[model samples]
Target: MPVITLSSDIGLNDYLVGAIKGQLLTAMPDCAIADISHQLTAFDYQQAAYICGNAFGYFPGDTFHIIIVNFFDQHPKRMLLAEYNSQYIICPDNGILTMITQSKPVDIKAIPIPATAKSLLDATKLIADCIKQMITGKKPDTTEVKDIEEKYPMRSAVGTDWIDSQIIFIDNFENVVLNVTKSEFEEIRAGRSFRIVLMRNSEFITRISDNYAAVQPGENLAFFNAGGYLEIAINKGNVAGLFGLQRYANASNMQNRLLYQTVRILFES
Candidate 1:
């Protein structure tokens, strides 16, 4: 049986999720459906990319991942179907796919829709049809598959003594995940001592904890999470809430404001 995983901003509070699942099952009753998440922040592609990128690789090859966040960006008349690393991803062409994979897909196609078919329900039906066709080994017309426009993830700002990173994700446990990866941190440190300073509170962490419990309860610590990204958390408390840290998209500002909290790591010379 085929495996279908869903990640979306469509929360469970409404019937949309159930309705979509029903449509999928009705078309392919034997296929297994899995929920990656349904509570993604609306139109937040970075958050969706981080969550999906970390989780998708663990699933069995050939799994179909349906990402439905920011589906209506600019009222798109087409959706993208991409195959990467033996897995399939279906989502809007609003750059989320490129953000998730951090590269262009091996195979990509644009599924067109009639201008009259503009509702979310219509879009869901179209997605279901695409899923069915792909599973049956029927290749979509070559003309349908087109070059996908790409979008890049935010890069950390690096200096001789400092690496300025942004909080890319905040998990349910309220742990703050930064864009700085373990390898990047180690490469820059080169065995020198460093200080991780939080721009929000002016507080700093000097040690990298092996686990959350490495520190006494209620104390703050930093560690590279399972995804290998640096994370800040309290042993038994909410780091984001306590530190007043949140995730926001990079955007223009009239005053050139910083949208999210920044974590700066300064390596000792």
Candidate 2:
């Protein structure tokens, strides 16, 4: 049986998630299936990319990853099947595949969506059928899919003396993940001292902690997380609630303009 993973914005609140799984299982009995995350925010491509990008590498080679978030942002014409890093990515042709993987794939095929396929469940059924064909060494279409849409992940706006990074993610613990990775931080620092200025520069963290214990309980700290992005947190504290930071959200709303804030790093020569 083939291994399949699912990532989506459908969440688990309803029967849709279960229905998707049922389709995949009915297509291939005894097939191993896993869930990356089903509670992802809809239309938040950057956040979804951050999550799916980090997750896909952990699965074994040839595993098919089906991402269903923002699957219908446009008229449904065809689906995408991309071969990348020895794995398979099945997603809608909504320009988000590049955002997740951050690369252009040379091998991609278009899996046509039948006119009868009107709902999300119908799409999953199509994907399930395609997977069946693939394992038997077949493709829905042999012609390479060209002229597909593409989008890149949002990167921090860098300055020579400072770096401004958005709060791309906020974990269950309320710890914040910035867009700036460890290597990006080091490249900008250049052996200079720096301060992580937050909340309109009202608060500052002068050093990166080795761990939560590096600071006293309820105190703040900065560090590179396992994913290599800069993280801001407090020992046994709710960093987002306390500091008023939030996951990337509505840019037009005044509150979200403040909530969808960035963590600033100012380098001192």
Candidate 3:
């Protein structure tokens, strides 16, 4: 039995997740079902894309990943059956699938799920049926499948300000993580003087310490996170709640929090 993993913005509060799993089991008895993550920040494609990209690699080969986020939201798109890195992903063609596999080569196919299957419940049933057919050694008919644009429109991984870094996602702990990697930041800060500034009250945090301990307790500091992305955090405070930094919700505020614009690094010789 092949492993089928499900991910989406659908919270656990409702029966949506259970309903999808029940449908999968009904179609393919004894099949393995796994939950990659159901709390995907509801309809935030980038968060879903990042979670799927980072977490799916840990699963075994032949895992069928089903992403059901933003299924009925604005901007209608097609279902996709893409094969990459020995795993198969079933998701919408709204570029989330493309972003996940941007660094690698993939075999893309547009799946034509019945339009009448408008609701998430109906779509899940149809998609599950299609996967069951594949597991039963039957190749699905793709004659009517609509092919997406040859290339996906994922924005370049590089930040809009190559010279400066962009604030991407902050964690529950209020750690400010930047889209720019440490290496890139180092290259940009070569011999140039800069400083990390907080946009909340225009407070200037000048010290770039090696770790949290490098700064006094309750002070703010910036360092490379485990993922190699530059991160900012208060020595012992919640940066987000304290600074009021919310992502995706407040678009204009995000631009104001840019490390270079809102926060800057001074590289002094």
Candidate 4:
């Protein structure tokens, strides 16, 4: 049986999630459907990319992923069918694809949608059809699509002594995940001591911890998460809520950029 993963912003409070699943099953019965997440924040493409990028790799090869987060970011003229790492992804023309892939996928094509079709279900139908073709070890019927929108994941702004990063995600426990990866951190450290500054110079985590247990309760600690990103947490406490650090979001406005607190890692010789 073919495996299809669904990641969408549509919450499970209503029938829409089931309806979309029904449409998929209607398109191809006997296909196994897996849910990656349903409570994704709409228009929060950064977090969406972080979540999907980390989660998609664990699944078996040939898994078809249907991403519905911010499906309406643009007019529904067409959607994108991307084949990367032997996995197939069907998402909107929005930049989430590039953000997740962190690069422009070489094998990408455009799946045209009917102009009259203007609903998530409408897009689901087309995606379901594409999966049917892909499971047969063939390309979906799509047109050559170059020049699709691109949005890369944010990275730390590096300096000789400091690296300024953003909070890409906060978990249910309120541990804040930064955009900095282990390789980036190590590259900047160069075997020097470092401090993870949260709000001000007065409050900081001076070293990387193995996990939350490495610190006393309510004490702050920093560690590289399983996804290889820097994460800040307080043992048995809420880091983001207590520190007033919000997820990174910039409307391209100066004021909008100030809404979230950035994670700055300072290195010392």
Query: Which sections of candidate 3 miss by over 4 Å?
Result: 74-77, 103-105, 143-163, 190-194, 199-217, 248-269
Please give each candidate's TM-score: 0.93, 0.94, 0.76, 0.95
lDDT (10s digit) by residue, model 2, range 54-143: 998898999999999887777687889999999999998887789888888989888888788889888888899889878878756534
Tens digits of per-residue lDDT for model 4 on 64-167? 88888877766778888898888988888988899899999998898889887878778778888878877767777789888988988877889999999989
The TM-score, computed over Cα atoms with residue i paired to residue i, of candidate 4 is 0.95
Residue range 222-255, candidate 1, lDDT tens digits: 9998889999998998988876777756565524
True-structure RMSD for candidate 2: 1.8
Model 4 scores a C-alpha lDDT of 0.86
Assess the local accuracy of residue 261 in candidate 4 as a C-alpha lDDT between 0 and 100.
54
Error of 2 at 162 (Å): 0.2
lDDT of each: 0.84, 0.86, 0.68, 0.86
- Model 1 scores a TM of 0.93
For model 1, the superposed segments whose C-alpha errors exceed 4 Å read 141-144, 199-202, 254-260
> How many residue pairs clash in all the candidates, one count each?
0, 0, 9, 0
- CA deviation > 4 Å runs, candidate 4: 137-139, 256-260
